[model samples]
Target: MTPHPAPQSRGVALFDLDGTLVDTTYLHTLAWWQALRRHGHTVPMVRIHRAIGMGSDRLLDAVLGPDRETGEDEALSDAHGTLYATWYDSLQPFEGAAALLRATAARGWRVVLASSASEEEVAAVRARLDADDVIDAATSSADADATKPAPDLVRAALDTVGAEPEEAVFVGDAVWDVEAAARAGVPCVGLLTGGTTRRELEDAGAVLVHDDPLDLLRHIDAGPLARPPAPGGTS
Candidate 1:
């Protein structure tokens, strides 16, 4: 009988874009706020800020509620997209964000970006991040049927890298990210750069929490990403 091939063990590191690596959380909040207002809705910025990690559809449902008129949803989303795109050229990656991706890749992790942003937006963020050399893959909203708090995006990232749930770790800056990772059976490390509280992240199932990419890079060896790979796996 022929012997079966052993399991491939290189772990996967999934990173969330937007507020996690880029300084666009508030920008997103502002855009969504303006979009809603333009559509004659008046949701609070604070609420919009908290819903930044979700996809536009989910964000609309979240801030506007299920009872909201569905006819204007497309217009609201388009308005927000146009507003947010105005800042594309000005987007900046967080401190150490590129280094973090490089460091994770150097440690044998296949780094993948898991985001709910549109393809164009992801491209803008990636250009600002300047870490494409080390990124094994990246997934945008078009790659998933659902967004954060639903696990589809997270799972899509895993599939892109051919990684099993146990062989991957996700990093993000929101409770929605943590919750999504949890539902996908992947542990998540939370960052506070998105303005989420430590307690809120913890409550949502983050394995560890840090202030930002710089902070997490400083302690990378102590977090879930530092854990040894499974037996028969390399790295």
Candidate 2:
């Protein structure tokens, strides 16, 4: 079950961790590929890559098919988790990830890590980034009913930070992230660092896109994150 969220805050900057803040896109693809193969399914890495942002609950169907046996889902998820965990000690944050968070926080935005990753994984990534001092709060899979493209996680993150959707801007690296933010009525800024193309993110409704955290930091004042929070939580 998902946990109850804390109150909201103003001028929130909600961020996706995996492909947005850390360099885990290909690592996740490889882990999923290995897990699928373990169950005698041999999906290609490219197909897995495209489905990277979806939670494990939805990813198998996205890469495999809806008709796939439901019984194997848990096993597959566990396999992928175990496989992915092997790299926890080696996970690295993208360049300027911490600085970006600090800058956003310095500008009065409550920085929150809004990711679909498990809390353990989120913590690992946060440790690697070493920027928790500036991050006000975070929401993981345990805080949402669904993952990206569903809006549940994004909405949960907003609630966790006490920010209305209109008071927040989401930064992510996947089309699912943009779609999720749109569903939550928050503007999204897509990052190409997650291996997703700018065209894909923009088409999914991202108001702006940047190459990485550094690029966004360089132009923070000129982008969606710079928008002021709505007065009195109007919407």
Q: Candidate 2 — which residues are off by over 4 angstroms?
A: 1-9, 233-235
Compute the lDDT of residue 202 as modeled in candidate 2: 88
Candidate 2 lDDT, tens digit per residue, 1-235?
Answer: 1223332436788899999999999999999999999999999899999999998888888998899898999999889989999999999899889999988877767888888988888888888999877877888888887777899998888777567887888999999999999999988999999888989988999999899999998998887666456666443
Count of backbone clashes, every candidate in sequence: 1, 7
User: Which digits, one per residue and each the tens of the lDDT, describe model 1 over residues 1-235?
Assistant: 0011222446888899999999999999999999889878888899899889988888888888978888888888899999999999999899999999988877777888999898889999999999888887889988888888899999898888677887888999999999999999988999999999999999998989999999999998987777537644534
lDDT of 1 at 185: 93
Candidate 2 — worst ten consecutive residues by lDDT sum?
A: 1-10
Local distance difference test, candidate 1: 0.87
Which stretches of model 1 miss by more than 4 angstroms? Answer: 1-9, 231-235
